[model samples]
Target: MENSPEIATDAASLRPAGVSAVALSRLASATGGQLLHVPQNADPDEIAISGVSIDSRSVRSGDLYAALPGARFHGADFTRSAREAGAAAVLTDPAGAQILGSDPGLPVVVTPDPRSQVGAIARAVYDSQPEDGSGLSLFAVTGTNGKTTTTYFTNSILRALGETTGLIGTIEILAGGQRIPSRLTTPEAPTVHALLSVMRESGMTAASMEVSSHAIAFHRVDGIRYDVAGFTNLTQDHLDLHGTMEAYFGVKAQLFTPERTQRAVIAVADDDDEWGIRMARHARAQLGAENVDVFAMRGGVVADREEDPDRRGADWTLRSMSRRGIGHRFELVHRDGRSLRVSTGLPGEFNVANAALAALMILASGVELETLQRVLDDDDPLTTDVPGRMQLIGTEPTAVVDFAHNPDALARALAAVDPPDGDGRVILVFGATGDRDRTKRPLMGEIAAREADVVIISDDDPHGEDPAAIREEVAAGARSLVEAGTARAVEVYEISPRAVAIRSAVQMAGPQDSVIVAGRGHETVQEIAGVDHPLDDRAELRAALDEMQEGRWERR
Candidate 1:
């Protein structure tokens, strides 16, 4: 967290150390942009910002604020605040350029397509060279679920193999033995290069990154070359942004492009996995520079034969797996018939899939299977905990907090749980996020109703969307299950106060019941209509569970 005071107030003040105006102009020229304010020969030493910002509040004094037109509002509206806050210059598309006025004679850079140029401009400013030259092996794991877990476990396995590792995921940044809060699952273009640069400078030999579909589509990871790429599984999620499941899957598939990665590893668990595998293979065959490696958790079935579903077994078979105090121990069976008993403190079957994906990446990176076996046995799995991912909150009533906001994720989470010891029911308290993939709201409801004995639908950052509307969607879906007789009558409740929801669920939960709180897993803040409200689901769930214990004692 060590930082210089000069750049403390304005991130713009931290212009990449050695950039020059000539270089900036060259970069501008490449993007067909015009430098409106500063002289072409202006000393680059004084240039502070590497890119532009749309939000003025986030703009540092040295930032190049961008006055772009957004669907909701014009970035130009924030130009005055940006300048007052110490913006060195402003960047805007020509349309915005005509509307925005600046005080303090702030410099303005005009381009026709400011948004398109942002990534390229940031790359030039940061001087992002290919990652291979850094002598560090960079791996990117992408999918609908398990991205964070795979990245986290990949870090662990890499560490076990004697390599210093860095990670960027939903939980936090695992860097320099410190946990830094993450602003985004995948940060913007400049920030990504900046973080990687820091990792390289720190002498890390390997780094594992969770690449979100949005990040790939937006060119956030534009400048980096991944040594290896891993896929977990794809499912229904993020439809709000991508518009359709196919489009969503297409974005995730962007990671396996041969030009972006050297080696590809795929997990064939879902129907859409074939698209990823086909794309990777096509990339290798067409590009000829990258190599493709396919992996299946299902055993003995040839890669092509597993397509039949009935014949396909897992590339790695797990058995005799017993849950022990928030962790699970199982034996991983490889295709060669050699099995390794792995005692991973990580919970859930999804985690085992994540571990298998991580292990595959390690093997793909040239780590021997024998070394991976020893690491799985001796190296503790609990050490690399992925936050909010089937994260166990308490043993009593067995409360778990997860980031499963969609039907697929919810199904996996429900399946992962050991279904209360005897007659205990799995009680789920969750709701769909507002303004996102509304279609999945009821699907999630049906999932909860069909899989869980009790369902509690609550708030999940309605963000400009009516909370009631969201709740109704979920209710409707759950109602579908009841009407269809797919499940027994579901117990549904609308609890606006999440803390109260957790408390109510805990109060009713018995020793045999499993309480699951999903959606907004590791998110510390609840975002609504672009405003963030402080609300950590994990903390709230734990606090409620602790109070429930006290209440039981008091009743005794």
Candidate 2:
């Protein structure tokens, strides 16, 4: 198993150029903290903080180091290191303050809980968000899946409309002309504020971000309110951290509150899943009915519900969809009979939902319908490449690489790649991530068995679990389905050293077959136990196809 790239901890490296400083006294007052160890002759209000950082090692000159308490060691243990790194002041909780003993040789801001105030401190120091609503127009998306693609679609449309845009998501962070690979679905609160400040400093007009459930639960997105927030559907995943699906939903719902966003666009496409409908209702209750918009892609129960006026039909609908090349052409129809014709070259029906959410989110952010329509027709921004998202590598064997790590995503990917008219079979290569929701492992395997013709159970960041054991758990589900003989005939294989599995899948595939390498989409490193190994699914798949082509040339 390979480990994720370490987050860039050097605050100076990530901070925006020429950011104005903020007074330490003002920050303490804003966060309801008390200033301790202020110099006898020095005024606390005159002490300037140029930046904020939670990690001691990331501290820079004129920075306020937030010494927070963690599960194991308190951040105060590194106060000497932070001071050595040129941190001008410190912000810590009561426990951390005690850990520092007396006269820690720096100005200290003591709060009951410093972690919750990190965002506010960073925002104030960086001036990331303006009070008069004058800076970047912020947009955010959250859900089990599609958040990345939706945010990408949103940024692309913003660019098409002639606005320089920034993006913060699972894959990377884009601040106007600057690009940084991301280590987390949502980075720490300080990094979020720093990137936004950078975008603003660069004269970017708008920004889109992915709000993971973990981010909200950990207060990673605090102190910033979005112009619009969109919700993709929720499903089983992340049980290890959240403990339950309901808990996960609650964390996601936090982003829809009036304090967090000015408006919301929610996808309620599935009638069987009430999570979307419930989310819409929650947003409406929090932000008021006028601020929330319900979007339906297939006109499900949400479109027909008339029992309660509050639970009424969809505000926006995606209809009149038809196949357009490998993608689809669809109409986004408003309840008032207004509509916009849009299309996405992306490979899945779920992508249609993603594009729709993006469009509606822009509309919710006050973009005119005509403007969006013209941009859609002229630029077709929705067709832009979202890396590793149903990414096509080859046409002959229909080779694709996708970040579908869960049951819902795996099933959707399989359905999208399965041939509709030809005899080509679906060849799937996938594995469940270790140290995650173990319950989903069998579910994902069953999905692959039912949807694909050949199932290759492989390794995906095994972390600390036994790789063979993880494969067996997944293989058990496929083997059970095969033994029961309840589904179509399927061939299953358990393979290791993921690269070889890619080659084996390609070797067994015919020209008409579709080969999908799911999970760890854009991730280049595969973590085994505690070490990170160099591996990229797209590179391996491409290499295998090139080898096969070379073999044919040699035969000739």
Give me the candidate number with maximum lDDT. 2
lDDT digits (tens) for residues 458-552 of candidate 1 = 88888898888889889888888878889743677778867677777887787667888898888988876788889888898788778877765
| Root-mean-square deviation of Cα positions for candidate 1 versus the true structure, in angstroms | 4.8
Model 2 residue 162 CA deviation in Å: 0.3
lDDT of every model, 2 decimals: 0.70, 0.88
Report each candidate's C-alpha RMSD, comma-separated, in the order given.
4.8, 3.5
| TM-score for all models, in order of appearance | 0.83, 0.95
Candidate 2 residue runs with Cα over 4 Å from true position: 1-12, 300-309, 552-556
lDDT of 2 by residue, 367-449 (tens): 99999999999999999888889999997799999999999999999999988795798999999898888999988888888
* Root-mean-square deviation of candidate 2: 3.5
- Native-to-model Cα distance after best TM-score fit, residue 115 in candidate 1, in Å: 3.2
